[model samples]
Target: MHGTSPPESQRNLSRGLILLLATACGAMVANLYYAQTLIDTIGPEIGLSPGVAGAITTLTQLGYGAGLALFVPLGDLFENKRLALLSTAGAILGCLGIAASNGPVSFLAASLITGICATGAQVVLPLASHLAVKERQGRVIGTIMSGLLFGIMLARPVASFLADAISWRAVFLLSAGLMAAIGIALWFVCPTRKPETKLGYGAILGSVWGQLRRHRALRLRAFYQAMLFAAFNLFWTAAPLELLRNFDFTQQQVAWFALAGAGGALAAPLAGSLADRGLMWWTSFGALLMLTLSFIGADVAVAATSVAAFVIAAILIDTGVQLNQITGQKIIFALSSDARARVNAAYMTVMFVVGASGSLIGSATFEHGGWTLSALTGAAIGGIALVIFLLFDRGASDPD
Candidate 1:
């Protein structure tokens, strides 16, 4: 805990409490993704043409970026439990709005709202960090993050299956009901921990940039993850198209592939443990190296037309990304306690804002030269991050 103790309800953070918070993160983050896998079907049903169909996912992502900029920083100023729970309530409304959408305009608007509310996951993270003891914070956060990763990995497949069984609307409808239950349960289960910051909302928002500028470690950590995340996004965005085109994969099969790739999230807790043991540099180096190499392996696997190799590449790619993510988050969170949310918001905003570009780059590269070009491009990105780390971060003294 900080100088002030955590609220009574969260003093212990037993297995059950951790599980609930992790589940909450998973469920909230999942909302940002369901629309992504169902774009083709959703567009056709809602009168959105094929050309503009990408807007459905794009607006959702943009909304999430907005929420991170606007709402996440508030976590540093407000009651943690109330802020997270309120965000959850908003997400439930957003989900229901999305479920009821009948047109392109309505669907897109609802998607944006859902994206904004999905920052509940971001809020949950620093809250968990605040509640956990200092020594074990990394491990606890990594476990919670594993749930977030699992949600991302599972959302596409779940959406595809649910849409296949019922309709595209069921995904959001079901999410709404699940969020409703989670929100209600958390109201009783969560303890109140008010933030110590005295800054008003405007000042808090302004300080986000200040923190980024003040902390060299935060910049490098964010940069490392941003690069890896860009590569991660690049691989995922193009991989599905490649599979469908070259491997003759059905939507359901792509879903399964993604589900299998999710196995990498299991390593997040291990990464956290390594960070706790003070092997941050080694962990990050290995992760970046693996990420860089995985793309090359993916290219080879594609050339051989071997699904097994591709699966291996998928696992390595995901593992590298998650491993680096856990390390990066642990580093930044340690940079400041009082401004954890603001610093977190700043770090994440950088990565996500930058990482969003990878999707566009991936789609374009894949379209032009197919998987060969796209995979190589991803490799180049990873290689850059690796070089930067080896040169600057490897033997350099960590800033306080």
Candidate 2:
């Protein structure tokens, strides 16, 4: 198919269609993360403590990892539209459960289900990849990823605002409604393509495990992303409480911090564009330098009462993390287009698992040592990642 005659429409979707698909992926994936905003609200509503409530996030991450390992490869074995539609439906059901949950157990279970269903976003990306030509794939993927990053970045503030205004439960219901709408749209609009392989689910899933063993690039990139994500998670998971406890900021104020990070996410397209220009080395160097600077800036911000410093730190941290993720995806997706979903599964599974661990470590450290210690730990990890990258044997960050 790579060298075969190309269809005109499949050559590239119109800009509008690409944006629409990207937005859809963002909306669908947002269901998995909206809980972060609602967690504080919903926890109090259900009488759960902050520590216990965090399990919702942990469970969701674990579920996402599991889905990446087991469910995403189905994209190669089933129709993309069918898989996305079904996943959307499942997400809607999961959101409904979240909206109705009355206890910790129910919330955790609902989150796990939503995490699994959110693989729709992963499936859709590879499908979009297949639709685009090679030359434009970077830009196309970058455009779609912008939506995904926005979904993740905006979820915190949006969820916090919605939870503060209406009810936490209402947020999940709104997401469920959106999921239904997307599912309906896909049912009618998405192309009907058949499976690439006739492998049974057993074989398909086993192949995921097999890929981990066989693909050196996949393993390396996954581990790298995992380390970076751990640091990213540590900061995000701990910062809110640090602000609330030390600076006496409101939830709304903390939510606003996410906006600054989103500004950073906007750099993703620029990073991709740079990669296309064969300047990824410079781009990465700059991004990591920004991250280091942010840590220094954060230290000053903590010492003073200036929110501006925190804002600057957020932008730098997010920029570095977003760039790393885009670069990682670009490399892994290039490995084997046929197994893009599996590759994504492997990458995301490891990334999120480490992210969960980071959150746990951050929270635990914060409980004992406070924000400074947590921040210090995060900075150390980020520095280690930088060292690893510098010492890495690959000529470029991408080891294709």
* Model number with the top lDDT: 1
Least accurate stretch of 10 residues (summed lDDT) in model 2? Answer: 1-10
Rate residue 26 of model 2 by lDDT. 88
Q: Which stretches of candidate 1 lie over 4 Å from their true place?
A: 1-11, 394-400
Model 1, 140-197: lDDT tens digits are 8889999999998898899999999999888889999999988988898876678777
Instruction: TM-score for candidate 2, please give it.
Output: 0.90
CA shift of 158, model 1, Å: 0.4
Q: Candidate 2, which segments miss by more than 4 Å at Cα?
A: 1-8, 44-52, 102-107, 396-400
RMSD of each: 1.8, 2.7
Worst 10 residues of 1 by lDDT: 1-10
lDDT of each: 0.88, 0.76
- As a whole number from 0 to 100, the lDDT of residue 350 in candidate 1 is 94
Per-residue alpha-carbon lDDT of candidate 2 for residues 87-139, written as tens digits (9 for 90 to 100)? 88989999999899888888788899998888788888877777777666667
